[model samples]
Target: MYELKEREMIFVFTGPHGAGRKTVAEMSGSTLGIKQVISCTTRPQRPTEVDGQDYHFITAEQFNEAQAKDEFIEVTRVNDYLYGIKNSDIEKIFKSSGSIYLILNRFGAETLQALYGDHVVRIFIYADRDTLEQRMRESGDSEELIATYLSHYEDEMAYREQCEHVFENVDLAHTVFDLTKTLDQYLNRNLLELD
Candidate 1:
């Protein structure tokens, strides 16, 4: 049986589609030496995405089976696809790292906060609608996909006030720099308290 030596710090990044939450999370994780909590999804993989790297792409049956077994820590349905984080995945990260970041939607982040309490930090990222649309187009998203994402944008943005930190991600470099710096300070302060 494996056990974590210390409580893990969970940073949850939530935002509307094309707001660059995933990109910022990845960059901040790399800069801070923190691992990412990759999620499992039933959605079809994009052309540039890797199966296990970007997401654990599974069949709907597989997702249902996992859910039936109570394997998911947080799960949600979006656009008819299931997305979830597995308990085992967090355990795997905690075996080697003390902190991890998750790219999640508002509901997923809320679930994590309910489970982890103070160990969870919720950060909301956003950009103007025009900027978001431009980003999706530049990333090769289909017009249909862009439309679907934008349709839900306002609803997602409404959750921004519920987050602990909010960032306007107009400039990727600045956002990544500020985010990583903030995370570093937070971790250091928490570690000192633990000591």
Candidate 2:
């Protein structure tokens, strides 16, 4: 049988842009009573964003140093901006009173799965081409940027197997509820074993 450990199963989630991965992360964490480390990035924060909550803002030098120290479990460059998950932050979160989900991209998610396959669970969120395009438009994403991200993550039809769960986010309300149920069971069983 596939047994998930009692300490906590870390979830590394990835999806194509506009697939609502971020929202899913937040909701999943909330439903499971855990924290979600939003991740750090060199990308400029938008007007409505905050430093510590939205992301940990870092400079190129700081990012490179963090990588050199092996402080990040996964680091990837997107459009000349560096984004990463801090190893210490993840450790502290899980070691503390709550669990934490590491929100990731395709590149980062694959890395985490490979490195921590025994302790981490991976889920992939995908959308149909038309649905992806619609979500992009609804998010106020520019065509050029959307095109760049899609090409980077590959076509919506390309196959990926690292994920244990494949969720279609076109109709996100239903998908969100279903995902919450899935995560609840995972977290509940593990938490029980820990006690």
Give all candidates' CA lDDT scores.
0.89, 0.73
Per-residue CA lDDT of model 2 for 105-188, tens digit only, reads 767877877776756777788776667778777777788977887775564335346577888876767787778777767666
Residue-by-residue lDDT tens digits, candidate 1, 1-195: 124344568899999999999899989888788999789999999999998888999999999999999999889999999999999999898878988889999999999888887888999999999999999999999999999999999999999999989999999998987787688876784322221
lDDT of 2 at 34: 72
Q: How high a TM-score does candidate 1 get? A: 0.92
- By summed lDDT, the worst window of 10 consecutive residues in model 2 runs over 186-195
Best by TM-score: 1
Model 1 global lDDT (CA atoms, 0 to 1): 0.89
Per-model TM-score on C-alpha atoms = 0.92, 0.84
Candidate 1, which ten residues in sequence have the lowest lDDT sum?
186-195
